[model samples]
Target: MFFDILPRVGLKPKDYILKFILPASVISLLLLILGITYFSGYTRLVVLFLPLLLMGSAIGYPYIELDSQRQKINERLHIFITKFGVLSITDLDRKELMHLLATEKEELGQLATESHKIFVLIKRWNQSLAESCRFLANRSPSSQFGDFLDRMAYSIDSGQELKEFLHGEQDIVMEDYGEFYKRAIYTLDTFKEMYVSAVTSVSFFVTFAIIAPFLLPYDFVTMVTVALLGFVLIEVLLVYAIKSRLPYDRLWHTGEKPTKIDLKLKKWLIISVIGTVLFTLFLLWGKFIGEIPQIMKIPYQIIFALGMSPLAIGGYFAQREENLVIRKEFNFPDFLRSLGDSVSAKGGGMTDSLEYLSSNDFGPLTKDLEGLYKRVSIRVNSQKAWRYFGYDTCSYMIQLFSEMFERCTFLGGNAGVAAHMIGKNFRKIINLRKAKYQSVSQFSGIMYGLAGGMALTLYASAGVANMVNGLYTSLDIPDTMISIVNIITPEDFSLIAYLIYGVLVIYSIVSGYLIKLMDGGHYQVSLMHFVIMLWVASIVGYIAEVMTGSLLGTSLPI
Candidate 1:
């Protein structure tokens, strides 16, 4: 039904503001105004709900569009560079090679679309290759690709060999790619610093907001709502800002068989589920039925901490999987170097070279290497077999390197040369990744500390509010002073505690995901970090509650 209406309003996927955000804003504003006018005393409820509607409209769809665009450009650009480099060195003719490049069915995102346009202009409209390339260059979305096209057009006009130009251009592209890789790492380092500063500052603000009810005559619920919204907004925007700078490539691979690790994770998962359920039941019974003793009563913060334990356990397993993959990748260049040495010495093909190399230890990759040797030795569709070999490795750099090697070898080119090039490029990338991870390691401590601080401050603020409210009600104040008192009762403090607790839950998750994304180049590996951060929030909240109660017992009238 929404889709049916979307077209009527000139909405499309690319026009994010018109397609999603503008309509969301219009509807939210209308609903907000209606609630304010029709309902007498629910302004706080309406205001509290507005953040989700407004923030999603303003930031959500735009970020989605940007992420989509980044993926398309990255994939397309990589494919073009890899393919152009390999085909240039092959014996395929200029026109035949250009035809293959232009008409290849492999989707290089916008690159494919533009290349197809160039092909159509030349073959259908009878435009020369130079003319078609010139036209395409003028309209290309990526400026770097445009410059490449413009150079290609010039090369054609001057009667220079397209192969030579492409071969030379690969060196330039690789250099640019190295710089690009470095810039992304630098951006991540900068983002980490910004994140620490932003989260710490927001933590202090939330603390102040929580304490405001004691001193200021404002709606306590409204103040909590604003604090929650403010924290959520900063975290969400920070995540959005970094999405564009992260790598977008992913590897495809053969199915992975379950191992001992899977079995261990499964057992822990069951235990976590049962433990969480039991904890929740205990909390409910204490809250609703009053069956538990006062000393045994579990706070909501403690309950939240216990519930997220399973995710942490599961995340550890995920981190292990990533670690194994990285270990395999770390030795990949050595494997490539060995392959090149074997091929150069024995004058054998990739299959024979791999059969000998499989006997050597490639660290974590030894098992996969044996599998690849069996497949290729059996002559079971070499290209498909090598592709799965790349996929099984599950490293983006390996995928790219393997594709280049596969292309060159399939073209009956020098396997030794291809291996050397792949090894060199892979080594450079690996070193950059190590440096990036090392640079970002210091920020992890900052995150853990800041997350705890935020949680503690929030919990302490709630404790103070409750303590002050209790004293205000019990005291024999003047009638005039009683009218001026702005007290948050114990019941109201419970609501605020739960609300702020929920906000902290989200902030911790987002921050953990951000840390993982910056370090691992993906967020799927963030579960461990997320779980740890949640535990930090939970523990800090409890500690703050205990300390606040003890301190106030001496300082305030009981």
Candidate 2:
């Protein structure tokens, strides 16, 4: 009711300062937002929440816009299906169209998120489905499916009757589409896992942050060692996160190759920042405690500097290589099964059928198979053709299919059975993908727990320092004086045991949350949110240091 009336009021917020010079900030901001909402009758109501609303909308926009777009695309698909009906292509009715739309909405929506490669896959799927439906009406008009291949496509391409020439390809294509959708689901599962990983990491990070610093005086060597190791461990977690989010390389060779040196430099810069922060903390401990010496400090710093450089280079190359392999081999197994089935069912010789079906160019599978047929047609031995298929096909199915063909001499003896087995194994590959996602979730939890635990520990240690310094002031002790309380039992030294215990709890919570996300849920980003816990700990530590240093006349340890 307010929405209908507010829009007609024509309100707006041109300047908050002008509206609130005499008023408080919140009141002025509220009035400005309300004004915007009031005028939204003629526009959008989005301006009302200010930053909060903006944040909410920003997060919600993907679902809302994608769903809205899906409805429009579904409508277009329905209309396209109707056109097939008019032309007698497919016998699919409204129910069939709705079912297709539902599947496509789920499948495509999952694929069409932030990744451009995924977007391409979805668009191609929709385009192929639309084309197939449209073509079915013209090709096999009398089959009760539609005349998609014969009348319409032949008229357009003015070529031979592909439907007649490539008879029985329809069922194979349908089977392939089902397999494609399955892979899409497996990929989407990883997204859900990431959210869980993020949450677990945050809780653990907060706990860790509050407990770290107190571990220092117990053994600065152990303290620095743990802290430095944790930093490297967190970097490894970052790498794992990147891998889970993207199945392939971060750089896809979209255009000219990017400078590898530049990327390596960027990675090193990040590593350097982490190293600097850690080393500085250790240096402060050595000077204050009169414990750290050049022998240990110099070598530790130098080793990190050298080791991190190679890690940067190796990591970048490994990511690129892995992604390229996936990119080249993606879905080749399924494509081959479809080709093999189409060839066998066409009631022709193996070589002829392979030659005929090669026109589809479904993927790298076709090109490699074409090599086998082309060589054999020229009187190359069966082994030669088989070897070519093995050499060119990058998928695991390559060796399996080549062996099957070579043993039978391409005589089509149980090739269908072998292809079916190959297809079955491909389906299992999807399961492997899901399992890796579970592994990623587990790994993310561990890293989050480690980082959070460290942050929390440092925070608590700072607070203790502040209290100890305050004691010196209250007792009117001199700057150089050593308190009996500290000599007998330093607070930092005692806290080490508790901090170590906290690490175990942090790990469990992190792993549990990641398990939840990977299984599926509306989980928040655990890693990013975990940063907030660290920030809070850092703040508390800073305040503690300031209070203690002021009271006891000691400089605050950074």
Cα-based TM-score, every candidate: 0.78, 0.34
Write model 1 residue lDDT over 1-558, tens digit each, in one string.
434333322345457557566777787887777667666556758664875667675665444544454445553465577676666666765555667676654435556656677778877898887898898776554566778889989998999887677667766766766666676777777887788788778877877887776788878888888978998999999888887667643322323443344455566566666766776676667765866676246666666676566666666665676677778888998998788777767775677888888998889899879978898888869787776677667665666577667777777666676676667666766776687678656766777787788888777777777777778878888888865788765566767877877877897788778777666643444666777777888888777877888988621221
Tens-digit per-residue lDDT, 459-557, candidate 2: 444445545544544675565654232321344433532343244334433443343344332122232223333333333334444554465555322
**Evaluated with lDDT, which candidate comes out highest?**
1
Candidate lDDT scores, in order, read 0.70, 0.41
The candidate maximizing TM-score is: 1
Off by over 4 Å in 2: 1-330, 342-359, 364-412, 435-453, 456-484, 487-558
RMSD in angstroms, candidate 2?
19.1
Question: Deviation in angstroms for 140 in model 1?
Answer: 2.2
Model 1 misplaced stretches (Cα beyond 4 Å):
1-79, 94-107, 127-129, 156-160, 249-300, 344-348, 520-524, 554-558
